[model samples]
Each structure stands twice: as structure tokens, then as C-alpha cells.
Target: MLNPSHLHRLFLYGSILLSQVLPLAAQAETPEEIACYNDVQGKVAWNQKGTRTWGEDNARNLCKGVVQRAKRISCFEAGILSHNNWSKAISDCAQTGGEAITAIVPGKQCIYNRGGYALTVQWYNPGLIVFNGGDADDYSKYSTPGTPFRTEKIALGQTSCTDAANRAAVVRIIGQGFLNEGITIAVGTSVGIGTGVLGAIACVGTAGVGCPAAVAGVSVATAGAISAVGLALPEVKEIAYIGVPGSTNYLDFSGTAWNVGISNKVPLSQTRNFAKESAQTVASSIKDFVTGGTPGPRSITFNNQAGYVAEMVVIYQIYKDFGNGTIIPIPVTKSSGQISLGFSKHIDIPVEIANLPISVFINGVGTTKNQILGATVPANFSGNRCFKSFGTIFNPQSSNCN
Candidate 1:
């Protein structure tokens, strides 16, 4: 019912509204675009130096292709490297699938060490790259071996830089000392003082105050220089020559001298001498007792029916009980492999006939037996009454004598 012009006006307004609404609906459906917007906003909130929100033109140009979009997401997700070192920055940029770009900036060179070696590193693109020297060559070659170069990958979402300048400075000082003393800085060679490049640097660095000459005696000779360097380091108690080739010659760090040669060792020698003297005394006494012949060797046999898994040790003791209530216990004799289940093994033991009113106690593995023999000479001997305890079973029985 509307006029043509009015209808055309209404259609134009509806088309404009639909056009605006369509883009938003499309954006809502595309999760990647929504994620990009969220990520961009978060980066802006964390606004570190050298980091900025990408402009519309710059974002469009940089985020061209599907691969480029993925790279963009990864770049934003990576942490910002804070230190202005060429090697570290290049490594950081490469981890996020980018190359480090450097530009020469005048009057920013930093000179370190007493040798006046000058180096410059300026972080111009945060995680992207850093400006170093006048051109970009391999940055890793410039780093010293002892320099505590951070090789650990930066954790995602970390934005702090580990300062390597302090550690590098200490290395340069130690390197200069070695060079002045005319000592070759061997990479893996074992110094006489048992210190290498990294160890020497750590020793001086941990001292907090400047390394003193007395701490690590940095002298002209290689041995003295290495020794001094080792002494200067913390946790080194004493340094003794262990007479081994290479760095294995260093003594243990027990704050005491460990003598390696036989010239000064006496403790072990004394122990051996004492053991020999004690053995001789025991052998002489046993010889005299057997030659006296007051009692000949008497044989005692033990028989068992429960087969032993292996040869078991048995100990026998003789105790004489007088009628006056005084009992004397003789020394026990130990014999191994003399007790068997199927066969009987005899043990020759010397016994005094005057000690005839004696009790014989036999114990082997888990079996114990006691036999009371009266004062009659080989006539009043009774059979053994044994109480056996093996594992969880206990059996008390009288022995059958043949």
C-alpha cells in the first residue's frame, strides 16, 4: 500500500542494517577471529616495552595466508625476551617461527672486561629480534664457553629476561687472568687444581666480592694458576696430589688430607699386626691344653630325620653340675655340616672325665637337645631329650639310641 519511493527508502535502510549484522554473525561463527581478538586484547593489557597493538593495515599484511595466521597466534602467545643480547634474542625469535632482524644504532656499544672488548646488543622488537653490531652474523660464536648463556627455552607466557651480562662479566675477568698468566684456556682439559672454565668462573662469581689474588693464586705457572683458581672457589676443602693422571689426582673434599702412598699410612698396618698377635695367643693356649692329655677326644654324633635344605651349623656346650649346686659351663664348640637328616656325622671333642656329671646341649638350626649323663664312665649316659623349634612347629621327643 506504500508509494514506490517510500518502499525504496525502507528497503535501503533494511539492507544497511542487514549488512552490519551479517559481518558480526560471521565473526561469531569464526572461532579463530574471536580468538585472535581476545589474544590481541590480552597482549595489549600486558603492554611490555617494544610490544604494541598491531594496526589494522599491519595486521592484515602480516597475517596473510593460513600459515601466517597460525604464526601470528604463536607469536602473541610467546613470552617477551627482556635481555638485549643478540644470541638469546635470535633463539627466542626462531622458536616462534621468525627470524631475528637487527639494525645498527650508533653509540650503544657496551665495553666489558679489562681488555676493553666492546659489544652492543639492543632489543628493538622484543621477541621478534634484536639489534646487534652493524650486521647480523652468527651470534652464538661470540659467546664464551664459560659464559652462563641461557640455553633453557623460555616458558610460554613468561615475559622476563635472565640477565647474562653479570655472569659474562665474571667470565671475562677470569679469562683475562688466565691470559695474563700465559695459561692456555683449555676447554675440557683437566687442570692440576681440578678446575675448568665453568668451575673457575663459578668459584669467583659465588664469592660476591671481587676475586682476590690470594683466594685463587693466579700466578705465572699453570699448576699454581689452576691451584689458585681452585682455592678461590667455595666448597674446596683441601687439594692434595693423588698421583693419578689428569684431573683425577684431586683429593676428596673432606677438609682433611688423604695420604695415597704407603710411606705415611700406619692405621691399617697397626690393625693387621694386632689381629696376628691375638691369633698366635689363642693357638698356643689350645696346643698346650691338648698335649696335657687329661682327657682324650670324644666323638659325639647328631642324627636328624627332617632333611636339611643345606648344611646347617651346630653348637655344643658341656655344663657340669656338682651336687653342691655349683654348675660350670664349658666353652661351646661350633661345627658346620656335621648334622644331617639321613646320616650321622661325628665331632671329636675333648672332655674331662672329672666333669662327667655333665649335661651336653646341642643346638642346630631350629633344633635343640640336652642329654644328662651321670658320673659313671660311659655307662650312665642316657639318650637325648630334644626340643625342636622349626618354623611354626615345636616338637619335644626322646631320642632312640641304637
Candidate 2:
């Protein structure tokens, strides 16, 4: 379980980072901390510039406008400032920066959950529809009957995503849905889907949330094909991001013939948004795509593949994750239980599948929050096409699947 974001030597540096943010907050309580909030932009932040010569007015102007008063010190971590004009703020201003990771996977950024979990994503260009217990690696043969669809910000219902625990569990359920039906995760690896329910860690298999039989208001007969992940979280935070925009089309394409690639970057940022649109746009929505709908890159009927009839996006109340190492957790509720950790906990986050040409790095100390932990190295990057060891042993143009 070595972290891939940094080198092996960096692994020694892992202990350098305080494991818990709470302890760091406690140890770093300073009178120089200041909280700032820009109501106009909905930005909530804390500042440590109070130790300098800056006054309250100077702090406000320097940190931008705060609706209330700024503090001179002591417990300034409540996040953002309020009007009261006092020497003390409410929150721990020790950790001054927001986590905005710009690496790993493709879709968007990974959002850290203080609840001991996170939301990660993967981008799939043209995306792919994979099956349960199927190898997600074979993007070329995704449509070749019996293969499962790649997971995207799959589905969501009329639930609320504010609850971090339920959110994590629901996302795990989505990964589980594919499993109970016979699969796991990664576009193509033994690493089960993602980590800690969201993405980029380790997923537990126990009893947790259940899929709402309906997705985007339409009933999806799940027939009890998903697993239960009983992961309870303690915090929620943000992670870095980069890559492409996500769409159920990515998931839908997995069930089609178009060879899709990975890396999630862009995001709609709301469950309602992803669900409302994916239901209509993504081909997996049996109610829509099976009947009539607008034809596009996702709607085209291919003679090579049959339409998806049962496998549907089941997670709901999403937070829009584009899996650039980010997965907007879909918060669906079932009876509460813990992800039994029933099986091996080594389930890794999927390694990058270089199906498309892209750019950028997955920036993180490799030990930081939202930075995916413990992934097997020498992750196979070879994909789709049939090349050779030294050169082309056979036909260079042939399929690797062949």
C-alpha cells in the first residue's frame, strides 16, 4: 500500500504530516489567525496574517471582505468571519489553505472527507459501460457482450448529499451495485472501484446504504444486486482536480462500441444536475434511451452491441464527481451497517488508463488528504491496441484484445 503520488523516499515523509486535522488545529491555535468569507463568491476561509502589523481593516481588505469582524487571535477556526469586532474568532485557523488537488484520474478534483473518506473520480472519453466482476481494463471490448460499464457519476435520486456518512456509503453502494450483480471497479484492474467508498483509498464491504429503486424519478428494479459498504466518516474536505467533464455518456459509452479512455476533470457539481441531465442524456436510463430520445454520440444504436436493459445507475443524491480522482458521493439510504471489511481491504483505486492523449500531473504529497493512498505500482498503462514488446511482433494495427 505505497502511495504513488510521491516517491518511495517520500513515504518516510508520510509521518511528518499530522494524521488528524483536529490535532493540528489544536496545536496551531494562534492569535494571529483570521477567518474570511466572501459572501459574493461563497468562499469560506481562514487566514494567519493577523500576526503581522495588519489591523482589522487591513486584514479585511487584505483577505477581502468579511461580513462581520476579524479576530486578532485564539480559536479562529470556525471558518469565515462574523461581525462582532473581537480579539477572538470561532475556528481553528491553523490550517489556512483549502485542499484543491490537481492530479490523478481525469474528470475533476478529489474532495476530501473528514469522515475518513473522500470523493474521487475517473474521466472516460466516450466512456465505457462495464459489468460486475468484469475487467474494466479492456476498454476496447467493453461493448463485446457481457462486459460491464465503466462507472461515472452514475445515478442519483431525490436524496440529500449534505450528510457525509450517508454520502460515502451511497457511493460505495454504487460500486457495490456493479458487484452484487457480479463486478467491482477501476476502468480495468483488480482494485475494486475506489477507496473509502468515494474514491482513491480502500473500500469496505459491509452493510450500509441501499439504492433507491428509482433514479432521477424513474424506477430502476435493482433486484438486490449491490453490496453494502458500512463506512462512517468523520470529516469532509476538498481535493485537487483536472481532466475532462463527466457525463453518464461516459458510463453509457462503456456499454457501447466506441472505445473510451479515462481521466475525469470537469464536473456539474450537483447531484440534481448530474441526475436530471444524465437520466435523459446517458443511454443507460432504460426509461429514456430504450424508447425515444435525442440521438447523439451516446444515443447512436450500434449493430455490434445490444441496448442496456437492466444495469442502471443506482446511486443518488450526488455531489458531482468527475473522477479526475474525484467522485461526487451519491447519498442513498438503506439500513445502516459498517462495510464489513468483509473481504480484503486492499481494494485499490483504478490506475490511469491512457486511452486518450491528455496532460497534467496528480499533484499531492502522496500522503496528504484526498491524495489516493496505497496503490500498487507498475500499474499497467498499455491499452486497447495491439503493439509488440520491442516493436510490432505481429500486426501493429491489430487490437490488443485480439
lDDT of model 1 at residue 47? 28
- The estimated TM-scores of all candidates read 0.17, 0.18
List the lowest-lDDT window of 10 residues for candidate 2: 387-396
Candidate 1 residue 344 Cα shift, in angstroms, is 37
**Candidate 1, which segments miss by more than 4 Å at Cα?**
1-90, 93-201, 204-208, 215-402
Question: How would you encode candidate 2's per-residue C-alpha lDDT over 111-202 as one tens digit per residue?
Answer: 21111112233322111111122232222211210111122342221121221211111122211112223222224222212211222221
RMSD for each model, in Å, please? 25.9, 27.1
What TM-score would candidate 1 get against the native? 0.17
Candidate 1: clashing pairs of residues: 216-228, 217-228
What's the lDDT for residue 237 in model 2? Answer: 16
lDDT of all the models against the reference? 0.27, 0.22
Q: Could you give candidate 1's per-residue lDDT for residues 312-348 as a string of tens digits?
A: 2334446678769998765454443533223334444
In candidate 2, residue 268 scores what lDDT? 30
